[model samples]
Target: MAKLGAPPMPWQKYVSDVALEIDPDTGLFAHREVGLSVSRQQGKTELTLGAQVHRALAWPRQNIVYAAQTRGMARQRWEDEFWEKISSSDLAKMARIRKSNGNEAILWGRTRSRMGITANTEKAGHGPPLDLGFIDEAFAHEDDRLEQAFSPAMLTRAMAQLWWASAGGTTKSVWLNKKRENGRRLVEALWEALAVDLSAPRPRACYFEWFAPDDMDRADPATWRATLPALGFTVTEEVIAAELEKMDPAEFDRAYLNRTRRPTPPTDPNVPKGKWPGLLDAASKPVASSVALAIDVSQDRNRSAISAASLRPDGRVHLEVVAYRPGTDWVVPAVARLHRLWKPVAVAVASGSPAASLIDDLVTAGIDVPKDKANPERGDLAVMRSGDVTEACGQLADAMNQGTVRHLDQVPLTAAVNGARTRRQGDAWTLDRTNSLVDISPLCAATWARWALVIRGPHVIEDYDIADSFA
Candidate 1:
């Protein structure tokens, strides 16, 4: 079999060094466990693909697996783009390409290496031992089941090289969330119970997590460039200034800056979209028999907002927000005004932190507050009621996609929505700490809790369908 050649690109060379340091004999890296937390578009794909080709050429009779979160993503990224580059390259032909079943099974005879891709389904990933494996977008797969299920096959090929690459997800899971949460709790419990768990080192396992050095500097493109040294991809001041002018703040945060933000609300493009036509004007007419007020609080000191979401008997909900500046305690008085003006049937305040305090103060002051707790269970209900986050994000994405959810319509609220990031914890979800966007949940929770007032027509009932739905 012909030997595989070294990579020519700088990025490839760096990865080559890493591979050689791990498995020098085969000039291939089989990471028993390795994590690559890289910034977006930093040539992760290029390096990985180059490495795959080099390994296949250098090591004959080897099996390689490439995988991603979804089949479509896997096909487009690895099988389509990366595979094309490898097969078209002179190096690929040098190794001799043989295919069976329309390239499903590819054999490079000169190097005795074969490569195949499997969709990220349980059935698709089932296979015999593999000499090398690749996982893309590992962050997108929160459950870790993919790693658990797929790694066994690769491990059976004990002599093979295994590499797991991903842009590590935001910290909100049981494993990676803040140390105060489940991850830390688990460590405490295990140490107390077994005592030896922490001290002992397990064979064939090494854990390494690499994050950007300055977590606080995510907004700077130079910070991103530092994570990706091989690309020669620098965010020049001119390019950044131009981007800031053209892209919305949300897009800038998510796409270029990698900042997590609030999701855009979806809208139907076929409908003629315009201003809400002065929600207060509609409210002044006293057309509605009852009102449901949902109030969301701010974690940061700068902004506190209350959104009045009125639900008519017809089942359509209307939203009008009255936001306030930091250090201003307007939530209770606002509720008072809402009560006197709209005669809202129920008031709901998010049930935690300053919000919960506000709810208590309102109740003590004789302003009735139905339970306004932001129950994780309620968020789950929202998911079930509206389907997945992707489905909900569709409308927000649509308005952005269709040019309908614009700045002119509601600039402040839209901007707030753009700064949120969500991660699923064990049976719960959380907003990213770095995100400064306002949360609608406290208000939504208050609104959901006030549904009882809706049915009773402004009368406070201790219990209602909304409360019971999650109870």
Candidate 2:
């Protein structure tokens, strides 16, 4: 990045570490889809340029596409931004620009590589196999037709990677929204499976988002510091304060906070009357030799819960809310401490839930939650997918009804159980934390812990602490 005359920021380098990782086995890109959703004016254009320029110079005969909101705007950018930068630099001798009216491209004669500028459309991804694809201003896209068009061409290229960079999108941004959700789930699944259980299949997407949740105090400088990567460089707290004063609240959120509003979720569900209180035993404790731990974070990112589950001597599962704490910064060290105290069979969390946010932090804490997709039940980090989540929810409800589970009479756990709500995942239903009246992290943590234990019954615990190596 320094060679390109624009030194990259820490966050940009951080994104590159994960998204640009090459798989040693395949000697190719580890992830097919790479995305970044962040606050506006965080050097996304420069970041995109760096990737496109590097790929063009590094690879031979690479077919790359850079699409913006429209063809005219794309061409304007190519002439004003990209060409000017490349031409003024040392790359001028090796580069060639074709600026014919409707169709324009940047060409490298020696490598025969060409980057075409276009408006993102259903046909933006057409022609010969695409080595790399860029969807600039990705939030403008309203549907998946372009992605549908891009997938086929990417299939033939062993090192193909599609990049999407955008600020948070509006409700009309169905394409970016789907990618955001899927990428979040994939990150959750990928880190757990790859880091914890190497034998598990890998996820195809790599994503990073630096944006505050919609509920955060946007007017605060602290909020801006957390979300805006360009702080102290291209951006400043004073400037942000000015933006807040001048801009509309929602627009300020979109431009500066990079927050998008979502449609309201389903109303509270009728939780099953499964003798919840009757199953509570003041003396209830896990008697199983091996333990399983689960973690959950609230949607607001305000609170977190860590729960343990193990079997009772008589056969019933024992569940306990071990920790309920404010904020998520302590979750990693807390889990690491617990793992040493109890060599759990699996550390489980729902794949697509808010708790998934912890996957990366846990990995950085020297905790590996690799996935063996073929044998999820046998892994150290049990990635509870939508199906697995629904199954676990059903299992918990059934166990409560059948009096096969015992829980310590914890206040937080009881409140979570009483206030929990369910939403259909497909044919089955999973806990809906967002729609619940009260915090549901306690219920979520216990449910996943119980499921992980039951699924991997009577396992030999891995005695070593994964986090200890880092320490």
Candidate 3:
């Protein structure tokens, strides 16, 4: 990084020590995966670039893939830092830079090695046998779909390594939290081991993290330095203070102090207290007009809810929970029965373990659940993503506040609305079931129903008979 005019911070050097560690016996990277969790703007990119450059130069004919959550982020990193550094250095003569859209690559002509930069998608690293994979903004990736896509390519490469680097993410950061927790456990176990167990295999991953205590005073300079390793040099106290003034305190704690915010009910919730009640109309009933059905199972799978929403003649949306059941066993059958009764426009199901587990049941119930949006025969099944959930929650909240939503004032739905807590991801907010005091499945179902009603547009309802078992 210093040779490229961007010097590494002290913390970055410490990260590099572990990330670049090599096993002498195998002549390969000691850790197959390296995870680094630290504050933002702490010279993470500088360290990553330096590592990439080192790999490109040292290993001949190696393929490296650098991916971010979005294409724009990957493109910006390639153009602004990686390309700029290479173009200014003598290394430019040894490589050929390809700037084609969606196929950006840097080929080391001498060694026939190549480095590709692309967005983190299911098919991002499909083509190449990657020697090294770098996942930037790792927290943004909620699942292992992208990793699973790349793992097959790296399986045969004995020296292949995957690196994940990011700051603290929200409660939805399941993958990142797993990595951190696993690393911490390994470290603790090793420290407590009094005798070497030669027969036991060594850990295949390394995790490095720096964070301030949850209760630390944000205004204290001592706490700032304790949390931010680059405070005195690359970043300053004044800059952080200004940022603290501009950002939400919880957000600041996550991005700067690297502290995961305690999941608590928001003081000013996305769905205001009285707004939901105002939107409720006890006399509201399901319209004969085109409607959308949404099914949601609680995280524990102990409860399931089926909700319906449709546009009323008065231009307002009417939403109501059709069924609130005790277990998931009856969900698919109930939905199949509802489909026969309503012949609705679409059935929206959120993507996660619950929905994934229901795919087989849905198939058994004779529902053709399309895998992707491009499927020509969608067959009334709409799989909602995390982004879709966020949008639906926001839309539902907005409609309630605007008095454009009318609910049936069902007890289960009312309880869900009252208990739902906001969980923010970037600028988007979704209901946080993990932090909610009561079941929010009804609210989730209603949100999805509303989303499907508005977003799916008008669809021709096909005649289909409900299976005898479902009936």
Candidate 4:
């Protein structure tokens, strides 16, 4: 409902005025979560940052958290951008803003109110309890992980509003896709397909998605306006045109137009004809305490190669390969041989295939094939994988640069590793096709599982020894 006589805005209205109503009294929305998808240069970041500041200013002793993907981003925001603005702005003159080494802050105002800020890790985000939070580029995070990270900010005295903003992502499963299609359906049929009743116990949270229509001709401005509500007036036509012109056609559609292209279900890149590296083939010595395992699936016409290596205690990972033989079920038998010889506690198979039946077969054969979901919180399997792979990749890169890690005589795996280039996917790294061995995904998964069983807590490496096969 409009206030009795809300003044008209010459430029744009405030976020509170235009935002969905959560609570009727405070004019504060009580959404469990809020998602916003806007095209680039539409003031999404500004709106979100302003909202955080507003919340902090409105309430005294409020604890606010603004999180990006990495510590560099964290520092960039506080040291380079936000705090710089605060120091320069009249707001700093009016308020007493105290900041610590790139992490904490205390803002005191004339109203005798204070606002604090902190960076949160995966395990700690949901631990502290929070008043308000801002998640920039939320599409990149795994499902529910953002919620966990923002859990600390839910302890506000009055109300807590979590603001998430992003442009678009490549995958359909991302939260951004849901927000774009499901928030408000056009017709009853479309509604049935996309809409969820907001009244559910875990209500469909409020979200706003802004993008150009898929079919819109890029040359026409009118066609763009229909899709990008932020255009002109606020976003300005010139800026939008420049951005569109700069992007590739496909990328433009996905990022700016919000068009869904047939996603290619993440295919494994073509591996060049090459030899497999042996354990003794290392050009350099292993890290202080490290483990590596090779997984070969046994199936006719479905031989897959996967290798995972990680350091003990430190959650670093190096994924070696994921190659498949076109016609032969060699994976199962090969994996069995590797198991008998090396006794690796963890081996990841790409069960998201016909091979899933084989996983059942393996379980029947007394092989451990537990679903990844049933894992620890702090010791989450996904966390371990991501952490380990990142660490491993970094270590591997350093070794390569320093001539530390040498391939046993230059095998296919060595060639692949040498040719590997990192692709940026949000805050994480995805293997670019050129040097990929079989696939990097499975290797990453196996490394994470290995870390959970090995370096986590008091557990030792569980008698899995490849050294006995030395003979």
Candidate 5:
């Protein structure tokens, strides 16, 4: 903080105090993992840099790694922020900066310790005995691949510490969401134990979160201070108000108030609120039931997703995305391969849609597809009209609302559901690709699959039908 010309906020001080707690017997940090969830631009980076400086100075030959979502971001933090701070401080005389091959480091000559900054990739945080690992923008990490790679580097250092700090992300943030949930559970447990007795054991991990209540008014000044510790100092209420005017309310809530925007039922009566979550089935698994395949391509045709809908034994519809990839070239082959293996009752595709261009290719591959919807028995393919698309979207929404459909809780699908918007076509409504903030291809695919499953009832699948013919 000294390098940044600032004092630690009260919340930052509290977090630091807990994170630096020592196990007297072992002479190591009590908490090996420390997590911080706060609003953006609240001096988190500064605090982390100060911690890195302290570790570099206190521990001789300590190896510290600072990781971000991208290499450019990591380098900016070190060069633009950390370097400026160190240059302005007395530590400048003791530190040496080096850059090479997309990697940068700061070496403390006196202690023989160094700090490295890079993007979080599969190969990052390796080849060093790490004493400290700082993961910035933790919410952007959708999986644990980078964390898994970095964990082994700390195994040899008994005093190693790992830190994760970020603002709340969307529903698809699997890793960050898990960390927040675990932290909340631990905090709740600790409070309950403290209510009964004073000498209760606390959780070993530090989970620090500062957020406003869900019901709080976002426009109120009190709410700003309650969530943003730097509101009065580094940032002012006037500046935030000006920003609020330019930003979306939901985005402002997530970035400044540290809140997750709950999905509300659209006033246009598209998808009902709370219907998606009610349909989640954790125990849902793939079975031998008759399946229908639906493929959806993004508006830009840069990405496509294929989904399967099947009728479970309990008579409930189950949907899942089987494949998602970049570019449209992989759509035909992938669908054909899945068709040969699964032998789906029908492959649904919308006419005049982005995916419609692949119907000819599918037919050329010796796959039977309906050339026209007028003849129902033309082939295994189901050609959908604009009216069919609207009806399918409505059916899927109604099924979820009535608990007649179940899903495996796929992250991409969940994200699409949360961000999807609706637009009216004549008298019917469909997902609005032009206005949707996130990709809804998964939801679109599921809708077509559901419609196909309804049109084609259950079919008996013989063991021989599962032959691997798509070599």
Candidate 6:
């Protein structure tokens, strides 16, 4: 893991120790099947990655299979995040990488130990005596066909183990739902019946979860700190609060709180039920090209938003609310972080708006926010004039009205768009951030971000996103 530039965190270490304990009597893995459930942005991915690398290198003639929801994703992750790091280091000499179309693998020459990435199908683990199987993105599974196949393949290995891991999922995740319920039942029974000492190392089945209780208040910072394992590391209160403001209640619960349930419609949603719902597309993602960002604060200064816009290859603009937090303090640091990550054409803020107040703070942090209006460059700030604000708002309305735009099914952004009202900017109109019934900062930020992207051009390198990247 140190060689991969991703040493395990404290929680990872603890979880690995518990879940990977060896049975003293049998001299084999205590846990045959382990389920790990945690919120997103935690180091769960890194934990699984480290486990696979260790198994491949340490065990002679061992075979390992790692899976995501799709084969392309699994292969991409293996090359970009896992193998790339090893190939650059001393580990490359220890292991050989094969990139053939259907025969991709990482093989250690001396031990003949090998690892492979697989597609999500019943045959994922077939044709191999698997020692370690790390099945990821379990939330996306609707059936147990893959598990049934993998478990049978692992039966031949003396030290075999199957790890089915994911965060919370919607009701459609039938397989994961059953596994979670079983794990929960075991945990409770062990606690009540005193089946075995909690500290003892006898694990036929391992269930580790970090989930928020049903009764806790989602908005409470204390609840967040207590529920999320990676809260302090990189996912701060500010980041979680930002996520809360832009995401659907169900999504926020599932992704951040690890509480999966049916997606319920808000009783009296701020966003209208009509046109906006039709535009909800969960698969829409912004390309790295023509990237632009914008910052905004609520009228009361109680919250802030940072949004992104990018030109899709199809020539459509991808507008997204990137972040929304509780206060102004974290906005500058977040902007700086995102700027470094995306390297967008510019970061925009509307003049006379609450976000404009951050100009000085942003400048103090060495992020360039030019006061006077000039031709803005990449790595510089784009301050929108009153006319530009109206133009941006009008452009966004035009796009939405024509159904030329797409958005991820985020409830907050949808509500913001539906609840937004217009204020006269001469003949044109601007989003009324102050007078809107619901907070419209996210929508305003998205509009300005899209405008900036259209006016500027696209430029960004492909991302090698770290699995353990917290903030």
Best by TM-score: 5
Candidates sorted by lDDT, descending order?
5, 2, 3, 6, 4, 1
The residue-by-residue lDDT of candidate 6 on 200-316, one tens digit each, is 443389899888876566888988887788778767889899999999877888898899867453332222336666656667888764678899999999988888876665556
* C-alpha lDDT score of every prediction, in listed order: 0.47, 0.79, 0.79, 0.49, 0.81, 0.79
Local accuracy of candidate 3 as per-residue lDDT tens digits, 165-245:
889888787777777788789877765663566455568888888888754677788898898888888888999999999
Tell me how candidate 2 scores on lDDT.
Answer: 0.79
Q: In model 6, which range of ten residues has the least summed lDDT?
A: 462-471
State the lDDT of candidate 2 residue by residue for 27-102, as single tens digits.
8888888999998889887788888887888889998888777777778777899888888887888889988875
Runs of candidate 2 exceeding 4 Å displacement: 191-201, 261-471
In model 6, what lDDT does residue 124 have? Answer: 81
Using lDDT as the measure, name the better of candidate 2 and candidate 6. Answer: 2
lDDT tens readout by residue for model 1, 1-471: 012222344544555564545544454343454445444555567767765776676666778877787766776675567656666666565543343433464567776677777665555446667767777776555465555556677765655655655543453322222211332354456557567566553223222222443233444656545544443543355665576578875555444444333455444232222333222233331224444454555565344555544433333334445444454377667666666676555554433434554665666555642344232211111111222222323333333334322122233443344334544444444333244344534333323333323333323323333322112
How high is the lDDT of residue 253 in model 4?
Answer: 71
Q: Model 1 — which ten-residue stretch has the worst lDDT?
A: 375-384
Best by lDDT: 5
Greater-lDDT candidate between 1 and 5: 5
lDDT of 4 by residue, 1-471 (tens): 011121222212444454535566555565656667766555554565556656666666666677665545655665566656555665666555565664466465654444444444565355445767777765555455656667554745346767677776766536556555666542234445545754433343665665655434655778667656556546677876887788776677766666554343333232211222332344332232343443433223234455544442223233334343443366556556655554543554333333444565454454563444443222111223444545544433433443322233323354334344466545656445334433333333333333333433223343434222111
Of 1 and 6, the candidate ranking higher by TM-score: 6
Instruction: Go through the candidates in order and give the C-alpha RMSD of each one to the true structure.
Output: 15.2, 16.3, 18.0, 19.4, 15.7, 20.2
Regions more than 4 Å wrong, model 3: 194-201, 261-264, 267-471
- Taking all chains together, the TM-score of candidate 5 against the true structure is 0.58
